[model samples]
Target chain A: MMILGPAHASPENIATMRELMGLDHSIPVQFIHYMGQLLKGDLGYSYHAGSPVSQELLRRFPATFELTTFAFVLMVLCSLPLGVVSGYYRNKTPDNVISVFTVMGLSMPTFWFGLLLIYIFFYKLGLAPPPMGRLSPDVAFPPRVTGLLLVDTLLNGDLKAFLSAFHQLILPGVTLAFFNLAIIVRTLKADLIETLEEDYIRTARAMGIGVKKVLLRHAFRNALLPTVTMIGAIYGSLLGGAVLTEVVFSWPGVGMYAVQSIRYLDYAGLQGFIIFYVIIFALITLLVDISYRWIDPRVQLD
Target chain B: MKEVLLEIRNLQTHFKTDEGEARAVNGVDLKVPKGETLGLVGESGCGKSVTALSIMRLVPEPPGRIIGGEIIFDGQDILKLREAEMRRMRGNTLSMIFQEPMTAMNPVYRIGSQMAEVIQLHQKVSKKEAMDRALDMLHKVGIPDPKQRLREYPHQISGGMRQRVLIAMALSSHPKMVIADEPTTALDVTIQAQILDLMNQLKEEMGTSNLLITHDLGVIFEMAQWVAVMYAGKIVEYAAVSDLFSQPLHPYTTGLMNSIPQIDQPVPKDKMLRSIPGMVPSLFDLLEGCTFQDRCNHVFDRCRREEPGLADLGSGHMVRCWLHG
Candidate 1:
């Protein structure tokens, strides 16, 4: 009521606002009512946005999703080959360099890395688009086909706008990717080194199979089992909107929305966002479990 | 020399440690005669497995390396062969059945695929054909429901079954020589006997020479025509299995025999089963003379002065001891 009600409202006005918003009920009754509203896909009203909390969250989700997807692809692409090379040539020069970089990536704060990327790529090099909203001020909003600006612009046959959105995405996406690369790389290297020493790997080698086949077909799959668990954790943080990365880049993501809600003490918005985060974390865990079953049949996910 | 399948001469496999270079297989010489089982018997940590791994070219490098050796397989010095050539020779010309059955096959992959991979590595065959060959090998190894077993992962099967699958994989390409390094050491007693029986049957059927490395003298007597007793990285005795069992020439060989608790002649409860005194000498700091000099009951001045060369007694018996020399 303090946040949603009029500024400096009297006690009578505050009580009326509370009753109107159904906050007058007992705690248990309020919980049941909230659950009912949640089941019906109503995340209450966000007076701050002059709309439902769910609608506000839905509008912002795709922006975060697009950034997360791009960053995820980058992290996987960069880390896999790096990890494989480092692990295969363990204690060699390549492994040593990669190990140093991965250690740095892990220890550095996500926001700190984000600032460094911006300083180098944005301020000094001027290669990046201005890090603010999703697009520049003059670019007309594309049709909300997928709610992702890049796809929407391309769908609208606006190649110019698509390029702008894509250009705007790269800086933030890379920042997020660099921050999370350490986990996947570290896990992959450790697992690959250990997996290479397994008796089965020796068996594979003894079978006249080439080294590449032995590493990839035999050893790599076994290595993936442990790496999958770590990937889930990294992925969950990415999917959870990487608040630090989001804040540093000013990327219009769900993380920023939650930050704004917290700043304003938007009760319904904060509650809905927290619940959504819980769901996302749980869903990512489920995905990891499912993938484990697929990768290694011995894993009894069922 | 009945047309040796594999021969090791002056094989020196050393492992670099913080202390010094540990000579795991030092100046060893042996041969696996074609179509015959040559049992390599030794106590634990006596370089038996290391010798087998050296022959297979599967020793992990950096910490362990073949410093100097000639592993002549099919008359070619494999130590000089390119990695690609060595790889081609492995599992096709020579297969190795490792000591631990539970860990020999990848836990994640199906038995069928693992076996098919080996089959396909040597033979230019379709995936389906390779899988069929794998199923055929599984059947040949006497696995019940070979089709179902192939689809199951290594962890799904019992240890004996895993060993059977390993054996099937090793024999799928009809390798010229199979180095079975303690093939049944990890199995239960009954399972051990069964594996040995399967190995025996497979050996005769395939007509492949065997380098069966084991500590069990009974297994040697049952399966091997000839036996080489290794003690601290060197073979102390090489003889026909019957001759060695009848008259163990080296003191280490005699000690090994005396330690076996005979089922027919159980000792009285008051008397303990005999055991060899003293530990195997550290490979890093071996004695200047015989490796077993410190432990040998018949250690003499000459034994202390110099290590005895393997002296060839008549009837194909060789002993590395001063008494025999």
Candidate 2:
């Protein structure tokens, strides 16, 4: 209300804003009216986009989803192997080296990391495409099949557009993945160390099962339970925390949309964005809870 | 005479802790002949389990190491074999059953899969064939409803049942020797008797040698053909079970024998059960002479100053004390 008060100060708009706020009515009556409109999927208009808030959110949703999914994939690919190596050769030189590198990754600020990656990969080496937007001005974007440019391009069989979008995504996705990768590596290494001490591990070794087989089949699955929980939490935070990365990369995602709404005092867009974020987070949590049963039989899902 | 199946010559296992090096098994020697059970009996921390682990090469390294030893199994020094070679021998040529059956088997795996895994690891057979062999072994161990029991996890079964499954797994590959390290210690008396009976029956049927390690004198009597009494990491007495029972030469062995209350001959109300006098000495300290000198009833100046070596006393009995020397 404090943020919106100044924006609604003009005489003609003040009456309109007062009607929208239900100023003459009691709080309970206004809350029911708001909920009724919300249940009907009416999020009102976005003053900034000059369109309905839900439609604007739909336009930006795929970008954030694509970035987060790509980052999550990168995190798992990097962390799982590093974590297993650190755990399998615990207290050795390789473990020591990985520990130091993960600590550095954890401590380095995300925005700074993003800028550094842009400097090296973009400005210095020119190995990456410029992250001005999701695609270059020359290349024609494919029709919005899935709304995600990368997927839509691939679906349309436009290899050039897909390649351009993929190159644009690499920097932001890697920057978002860095911290989560560090967290997974550290957590998994600790869990693996404890699991390796289990009697079953000794039994596996005593049976003359190869070390690789013991680690992958016997130890990895048991060690993964705690790490899976960590992944869910890290993913949740990434959805909310991608604001800086989105801003730095100039990517048109829900986080950037939220920032623009806040700056322009676009109340409807902000409210809709918060709701969408919470729903995605809740769905991820539900997926993780269901997965726990499959990963470990001892986990009873009530 | 029976052919020797396994021999430990001057086996020494030590653990390096933050405090100092703990000489868990210092200069121990014993042998198990083919088709015979040799009992290595001692109290906890007397390196009975370490000796078994040493034979299997399963000791946790870094903290525990087999410093000096020749574990000759079936005429080959196993300690000299590569880790890959040793692994091939384990669960195939030589296998072990541990003490805590509850925690020994992997909890996550089903009994059938775990048993089948061992068979497939040692034998070149189809998974179906291995499962069939596993079911056969489970039936031989007297588990009820072998097929139904195979599908259950370790936690789903009782402790005694888990131990039976372990024994079944150990014998599935038909290993020539099985090292049972206090296999019945964690079980109740009835279960212990049942497991022992099953082991004895299996040994007779398969003609397999066993190194039975236990602290229970009664178990030694029931299962072991020969007994080796270990005191402070040294084998102080070695003989046939009957001979060792009738004439315990070392004071430690005598203390152990006297400690068992005779059921046929009731003790007087005023008398107490006999126990050894002193605690087992700390392995971290260097003893000048005998490790058991403080606990021996007949400790003398010679015992305090000079360590005694094992002396053959005609027949097959041997003793490691100054009196015998």
Candidate 3:
């Protein structure tokens, strides 16, 4: 699993590193050489993985993608309404409690939270098994359909497969959710508070409309613009998927894969992950920029 | 003389502060006859705005509260009504035009939408009807190109146009009484005069009674038939405009009249306006006796120790100074 660091580099790696990093050559020449290599679908072989880096990434990608997607859904489900109420009752007891919890969530290390969850939920409560691997070893997996375990299992019509996959995912999903949820709730609460103070909300109240209508129609709609932007900026953090959480739970996601790759000086896999995140982040940021124009008419792109 | 439309009987409003309850509107009584303009004139912090707000029951509670008051309008006590009932009455039977035109309109909404919303809220009108009324109001206010301006934002319009739009919106529902709180304060001199002219014209056409609140005595002379001079949270003098101006009884009122710079008269060597001597008393640390004693140059032994009631002098004139006695 683990190999040596770049201290003892192969002749090929040395040449590539020199060319790419400009440790020994001009930037343009190195960029051209890098582009040529990249264009040929040659991501190079992983020293730790002992296979093509792309193939290794492809194998691990589904697991990380599934984890983050579930986490994102969980985050949204908890944050939006909670944030609204908390903001509506700002500085009140409920808001104060939520603030304290979010602060604790942000301060605690991901590893500690992940382990604590595993200890209580799995070890003590026995509601769930100690999370390890993507699916049960005994149950044979069908061919990947959408690269999502739950979806693929459902597509295969194997109820047993779906349940097994769902069970294993619950802990890791919650662990990942803690940090994202805290960030979203805090961001949304602040945004909603600012929106509540805007004159439109006061105008709505002055109209003698019900408070529910005032909040939903005026306050929340105005608050969502900033929330959308915050979500986009944080999309990159998902790919890196709570590294300590992955290690503690032993969920076979890209986070663990990336960590193992790094241990071995697996430059190919490391570069693959870095480049992958860069492209994904760039694409999401583009989506965020486009979204602002759609939601707020005043937002003009020069 | 017209019939009385609104009557305030012994109104008192207090504000809860760190020290104690600071009475902002102390036992003041006045009346507005139907279809007549009543000017509430005073210096800043004289609680003129508070009195206007109290009439509408829009005074902010906790810090601001109507401790004792009876705002009787349209044969009903508005202060005693439930919030929902008050909401129905407000903007339908009564409406107010706020001071700052710039902040009055919501920034996020188009003018048409906000205006239409107000119409629909009070009247069970269809959306189309609301839109038509909004457009009509816009046109009535003399906004250039009503259709184009309706879709535009508040910031897009000029200050004068914004004030007109506000006036239009306030009058759209044909409320019985309209309170214009320093409507022309935040405009240029030319814009101020234009707005004043427009308001006068609109008031005449609508035949709706207006309680115009302003510190500008010039505007009071032009628009108001009856004037009430407020000093330190109390109505120090009340009379017909001609009577009050010709023989002002309260020292505060006289001080205020002397402060007004006259362009028609020859400029004196000093050419300086005679301002009221001292600053207004802090509402928090209210004195035992007269609130105006510190500022009144004609203060006597009893003037500093005993607060005078608003005593009727003669005819319709009322004064609250020892000099009147």
- How much lDDT does candidate 3 score? 0.81
Tens-place lDDT digits, model 3, residues A148-241? 8899999999999899998888888887778767787888899988886664554445444556766776677668888887777666578655
Q: What lDDT score is found at residue A152 in candidate 3? A: 93
lDDT of 1 by residue, B1-325 (tens): 5888888888999999999999999988887889999999999999999998888787888899998979898999999988988898899989999889998898887888888888988999999999999999999999999999988889999999999999999999998999999999899999999999999999999999999999999899999999999988998999988899889889999999989988889686876677899998999988888889989999999998899998899888999999989
Residue-level lDDT of model 3, residues B1-325, one tens digit each, is 4788998888999988888988788887888889888999988987888898788777755578898879899888988998888877767778788777876776656888878888898888998899899999988878889999888888788878988888887788888888888989999999999888888888888888989999999899999999999887888899999998898888888998998888887767785778888889987767877888988888889987888888887777888887786
Q: For candidate 3, give the lDDT of residue B181.
A: 88
Residue A150 Cα positional deviation in candidate 3, in Å, after optimal superposition:
4.8
Which lDDT tens digits does candidate 2 get at residues A33-74? 767888998776787778888888888878888888889999
Judging by DockQ against the true structure, name the best candidate: 1
Q: Number of backbone collisions per candidate, in order?
A: 0, 0, 0
Candidate rank order under TM-score: 1, 2, 3
CAPRI-wise, candidate 3 is acceptable
lDDT of 1 by residue, A1-302 (tens): 45645665878888877897788999899899999999998998886677898898889889888898889989999998898888898899999999898888888888898888889988999998778868876788897999999889988999888888888888888878887888899889999999998998898888888888888888888898788888787788778777877888788888988887887878888888888888888999988888887898877853
